[model samples]
Target: MTPVIELTEIERTFDADPPVRALKNVRLRVEKGEYLSIVGPSGSGKSTLLTTLGLLDRPDKGSYRLDGIETTELDDARRTALRGNRIGFVFQAFHLLAHRSAVDNVGLAELYQKGERRSRTQRAEAALQRVGLGHRTLFRPDRLSGGERQRVAIARALLGEPSLLLCDEPTGNLDKANTNAVLDLFDELRAQGVTLVVITHDEEVSMRADRRVRIDDGVLSDGSTSFQGSVLR
Candidate 1:
């Protein structure tokens, strides 16, 4: 089967005064249903890599194949379509609208998606339940805790049953208890066959994944170790 994500000799550089090389000679492959983490500190190009992987920005040079489709030269509109349809994103900040209920927040993701055949509310509600937030569907962001809001975010990401989840510091704002809750949910997702790629600076989060890689100063290297598949919930 084709890999969910494939990057070969990926090179990304920003044209600053000194021309910062955000990613250098990167190569990675993430299989379907696999949970992988990329760990790095600030100024380590993690954010740049995440942006490239999510198609938010194209690489300066390289081949990126998503589910076997070459993406290097795809136009912005096509990239946006592919991103909305196939990629799920969860970030450190809960980007929920303050006035919208959890269900609405998730439903909004599908508002712009063309040819969707399901009821938006029904699909959004099911996604909330998947993240164990069914009871909070009617609540607004202000009424939810940090973890709950993040769950809402995750639910929004799951709107189209995205094949790959790109999470950047997903639990960075949550307390330890809430972090574990979110991680458990991720484990469940992995078991259910959603590919996850998390970019984090936290080692504990990195260790929970089946495989881990470290990115430092634009270079990528293996950083895996034997550990619990889900960590302690």
Candidate 2:
């Protein structure tokens, strides 16, 4: 079966006073419904790789195929449309609007789809309910706890019903309890067949994924040898 995400010979560079290469001919493929993790130290091209996969940025040189469609050459409009339809993103800082209610935050993602305003709101509510946050839907960001806020973000991501979910340090701000809650949510999503790609530095988070890739100066390699600083599998 064709992979959900495929990258071939990927390279990303920054033209600083002294040019910098963030990624170096990295090639990767993520199968459908798989839970994958990318872990590395800062400046290892992990973020670069995520943005490229999310269609937020284009690689300097490489071919990216999303569900078999080549996306590297698409214009901004087409890329935006593709992202709206196929990808969902969750960031470390639960990027929720401070003034918006949890339901509204999630409903915002639904605005990208073609639908009546009421329908979108209903969908968002259902998404929040699915994430076990039905009671907190009316609360604003400040009114919710960290885990609740993260769940709101996840609800927003799920609102899109995309085939792929990209999470960048999802549990970065939470304590152990909240972190486990978020991981449990991921497990639930995985059980339901949602493909996940998480970028994290936490060993516990990385271990939860079926496959982990480590980034070294932009190159993608199996992280099996580097598992929690010791070889496993």
C-alpha local distance difference test of each model: 0.88, 0.87
* lDDT of model 2 at position 88: 89
lDDT of 2 by residue, 106-151 (tens): 9998777555676887898899998899998899999998999999
lDDT of 1 by residue, 1-233 (tens): 99989888888999999999998888888999999999999999999999999999999888999999998889999999999899989999989899899999999888656545568899999999999999999999999999899999999998888889999999999999999989999899989998999999999999889888888888887744322121211
Off by over 4 Å in 2: 224-233
Model 1 lowest lDDT segment of ten: 224-233
lDDT of 2 at 148: 90
Candidate 1 ranges with C-alpha deviation above 4 Å: 115-118, 224-233
TM-score for candidate 2, residues paired by index: 0.92
**For model 1, which pairs clash?**
none
The alpha-carbon deviation from the true structure for residue 181 of candidate 2, after best TM-score superposition, in angstroms, is 0.3
Q: Name the best candidate (by TM-score).
A: 1
